[model samples]
Target: MAPSPVRPRGRGGYWLFLIPGFVLFTVVIVVPFVMNVATSFTRWSGVGTPTWIGFGNYTKLFEDERFWTSFEHNAALIVAMAVVPTVIGLVLSAALFDYIGKKFGPRTASALRAAYYLPQVLPVAVAGVVWNWMLHPSYGAVNAIFGTKVNWLGDPGLALATVMAIMVWFQLGYPVVIFMAGLQRADPALHEAAEIDGASWWRRFWHITIPQIRPEIFVVLLTCTIAALKVFGPIFVLTRGGPGNATMVPSYFSYLNFFEKANVGYGSAIATVLALIIVVVTFLFLRVQERDS
Candidate 1:
């Protein structure tokens, strides 16, 4: 018999591969996060010495009505980006995979999926600018088509709603793609067996499809919720948190405080708080998922 290959030395060499990534992560993420937390306890204007102010920034942030309003907008965004999209994506993915794919062809299903995912591939800035122009009160395509001068992004009452709708559209594609991919892992035989048992589509969806893709649903909701909380680009391009802060969210609020107002310390505090909330939310989501699993 051929001599057995010498046993590889203890797998210690593989650990070296992690060093580069670990270093990069520390420099890019860990260092900045630590600096940010330190900055939150001071009064800094991005330049010059930071004056230590303890929890003053946090104290002020809590009392700022704008902060509360921003969070309230974030809550609505969570609904639009996470809740609504997940529900709709579930239905759409199931239909596209089970019904359209079988009835029309795989090519047709893929084409439709690509169309839905088109928005996700577009740069956020470009999408925001296009939407802004299309929703313009004066020359917007939407208003022109409808022959109505509705200030889609300018009216405080309508601004948040408009933003929410835009978010829903922008976010729908992500869940659809994710859920469709997850559905690929689902056992086709289960669906066939259910069908053979005279199970209707709705019954099969509720009993088989949903359970099969539960993990994807959880992942989508978590990511979308975090994205909603940190949303800033669209608000910056579309309304700049204008029309009386109707579309303001924590990330935009922090941006305003940091650059526009030159209140670096306060901005750091806002960022810290937002980060904390995201951590808590993630922890809660994980715990719930663990329990269910």
Candidate 2:
């Protein structure tokens, strides 16, 4: 009898296909994360040898008032980023799809969606810079429009809230587009049935529209919360965390330590803390999704 052909020993071609992506992931994510975790427990200036200092960095974080200050700012921004946008987007999208589709036309609704999504298309840095100038105390359009000299980015009390407003402007478009897309996939027949049963617009929205778009709501909330947690570009350009650090956020704080202060260990620790917080938040969001599902 002829000897049986030797079988291949491994998934050679399949492993080859995975090599590039696996290498990329190891280099981009795993290595850096391992480095960050290691550095967080040591003292380093990004140039010299790192000295292991145990939980020194963790202790320092709590004692450092700036860390808490930045965290508070981040917390407030969550409301601005997630809550306001989700509510307003729902209302705006409903108005366009439900009311406008009845009276005007679908094309008009489409045009308005594009218009609302315009702010999100601009680069964050560009939008921040433009708003920085627009909120200038002297020659800014805001002062011009209101016929008053208001230092929007200067006062400690107003600086953070003003930045929140700009954030709202930047974030508004995302949810509107997402909600509108969700609305498109909803059954129009359900709305007609509800209408025939004499459901008012408010009742229908609460019962019908919301239930159908629960997944979109979670998407919007989770993404916006993450964005708020990592907010830096707008703060960097607009406020520079000014007005006595009123607008400082965790990401910018990490940046300040890593670059300006040259405290690599501290910066890494702060970043690791942020990563943990994000992980927890995502876990909670996923749990919520599971329970609801």
What are the TM-scores, per candidate, against the unseen true structure?
Answer: 0.92, 0.94
Q: Which numbered prediction scores highest in TM-score against the true structure?
A: 2
lDDT tens readout by residue for model 1, 1-293: 99976667766687898999999999999999999999999999999999999999999999999999999999999999899999999999999999999999989999999999898888877789889989988889999998898999999889999988888888899999999999999899999999999999999999999999999999999999998888888889988998888888899999988999999999999999999999999999999999989
CA lDDT scores, all candidates in order: 0.93, 0.94
Residue pairs with colliding backbones in model 1 are none
Residue-level lDDT of model 2, residues 215-275, one tens digit each, is 9999999999999999999999998898889899999999999999989999999999999
Tell me model 2's lDDT, rounded to 2 decimals: 0.94
The residue pairs that clash in candidate 2, if any, are none
